[model samples]
Target: MDRIKEKMNQLRLEAEEASTKVEELQAKVKNLELENLTKEQEITSLSHKNSLLEAEVEKLEETVKTLKESAAEGQAHGTQNETLNRRLQLLEEEAEQADKTLRETNEKLRQTDIKAGHFERKVSALEAERDQWETKYEDMAKKYAAVQKELEEFQMEIGNI
Candidate 1:
């Protein structure tokens, strides 16, 4: 009976440890989810900025084309044309940089998504383990109760003798 009680205590301790681990894992999962959300928001913002930059580049291209046509019609607009060309080149460079940044952001998001999935799986496994531990603890508790009842009955019989 003492051995059974000791085993029950051990099992209870194990169950509590498992429960603590599960809680820690759940907290980690929540933190990862929040980080995932933040990355997604950043990706969205980058995409919007890229689109705006592309639109601006298109307008600049149109203006450059018009200026070139005027210059061909004998307009002394060489200086203005050169300035516009330089501005257009700078805009194109800016657009390329933005595109590169967007691509990098997308890759980061993909990696983060993968990490989140891994954590989710880990959390699920931990939760399952915790459930098993809880079941074991309940079984131990029942056995301990039965043992105590038997002890009580034995004591009563001895007293009657």
Candidate 2:
């Protein structure tokens, strides 16, 4: 009977040890679940922040595209302005030649007055021609100035753009 009691006591001790091990395992499992829940919440917050950053990046890209388009338009305008300036230069050269021709014609008329019998008539016609040339020259000069002013304003606008 003593030996049987000793055997029963050993069985009881083994059962107690098994129960304690089970409790430790259950506590460890509960702690792991808590840690997993905390990690999941952090991941959700990080995902939301990542989406917001992506939206901002998209907006910045659109702005860059608009700026590039504006630069291209400005370059086109600059080329057109250069062409206009070249035309104005040609017009200026023509005006200068017209003035020189008028001067030469007036000198010829003065010499004709000294030698020709119909000097008065010749002088009057030559003066009229000179007056017309002067009017046309002045008009061309005014137009050139206006065009130059316009070109300057266009250049300023391109810079601003």
Candidate 3:
């Protein structure tokens, strides 16, 4: 019947649309995953830099202690002690700046992880929608086939009469 054919066409179109939407969502999820990976790599690099800065700060602190001991024994000049103090101050400042940068990088990585989780949820929902559409399409196809068979059987009966 014309009505049955029309219904089949509509269901087919809806199924195709659902499939396309699922594909688009999957692509978006892949892109978000890649972005998360990039952010993780950046965090790793920043952590390494922070560790190196910490080691430098420790070395400078040791040097300052040795200089203080020399000054107590009156072996080191006053000017040299002042210069070492200034250098230690600068190194401490650099270490603080590095620590701040590391914290900011960690925050960014956390945000990226959140975004990736959101996209993953969306993909899962879309996939479920697509599966429902496929099931509906299959049910419609079977009904159409049954209707066509009924029409043929009625035609054969009329011809015999």
Best-fitting candidate, scored by lDDT: 1
Q: Write the per-residue lDDT of candidate 1 for residues 18-116, one digit (tens) a residue.
A: 999889999999999999999999999999999999999999999999988877864557767888999999999999999999999999999999999
**What is candidate 3's lDDT per residue for 1-161, written digit by digit as tens?**
88988998888888888889889888988888898899899999999999999999999999999988977767555667888999999999999999999999999999999999998999999999999999998898898889889889999999989
- Candidate 2: tens digits of C-alpha lDDT, residues 42-144: 8898999999989998998998999899899899999989999999999999999999999999999878867685767788899999999999999989999
Instruction: Indicate whether candidate 1 or candidate 2 has the larger TM-score.
Output: 2
Q: Give the TM-score comparing model 3 with the true structure, all chains together.
A: 0.40
- Cα error of candidate 1 at position 55, Å: 54
Better of 1 and 3 by TM-score: 1
Better of 2 and 3 by TM-score: 2
Per-candidate TM-scores read 0.46, 0.55, 0.40
Give Cα-based local distance difference scores for all models.
Answer: 0.93, 0.90, 0.89
lDDT of 3 at 37: 90
lDDT (C-alpha) at residue 72 in model 1: 82
RMSD of 3: 67.0
